[model samples]
Target: MSTKLALLPYAAPARYSRDERLRITRLAGALRLALNIHPGNGLVMVLGHGGEKNNLEALETWVQRSLEAQALPPNRASLQPLLAQLETYLTHWEADK
Candidate 1:
């Protein structure tokens, strides 16, 4: 039998200021564009590996370090929340394996 995954609902917290929400949205768009431009990036590979916990951990660590090194963009402070959102989004697909 085939199982269908339900779509995850996402609503930004009310505590986030309007500017913060806009920043998150912009960051998300940029990420989507980058992923589209480079289909074989590590993040895509990790997600395609069926949501293994270790893969997620490795990706998170790499991303955190990259952010700290200012290799990504914006700033670590701005990107942290987006990273959390990405984690939650990916975690929702864990059952697809």
Candidate 2:
């Protein structure tokens, strides 16, 4: 028996639930702000040959920070601002459509 790992197609778009979308949207926005990255740039996933990506070092820093945040005691004060921002973005998204 042999074990193999298959690489999925790069162009495929995966489905995400509304909550999942909102969570990631907020995370990306916060990371962009923290790292001072332009709106046109900074994503971990490279969609194609010329896709944008966050600063590699900055992204690593974000990962470490997020993991650390999760490990700490729940603090609503820390998350409230991000949640508020997410709510504003989501509201605007609906209004735009």
- TM for candidate 1 is 0.31
TM-score of model 2 vs. true structure: 0.33
* lDDT against true structure, model 1: 0.44
lDDT of 2 by residue, 36-79 (tens): 55544333342112343444433333333443444421232435
Q: Could you give candidate 1's per-residue lDDT for residues 42-76 as a string of tens digits?
A: 45444323242444333433343334344354433
Off by over 4 Å in 2: 1-11, 40-97
- For TM-score, the strongest prediction is 2
- Quick one: best lDDT, which candidate? 1
**Clashing pairs in model 2?**
none
Error of 2 at 70 (Å): 17
Q: Give all candidates' CA lDDT scores.
A: 0.44, 0.40
Our model 2 lands, by Cα RMSD against the true structure, at: 15.4
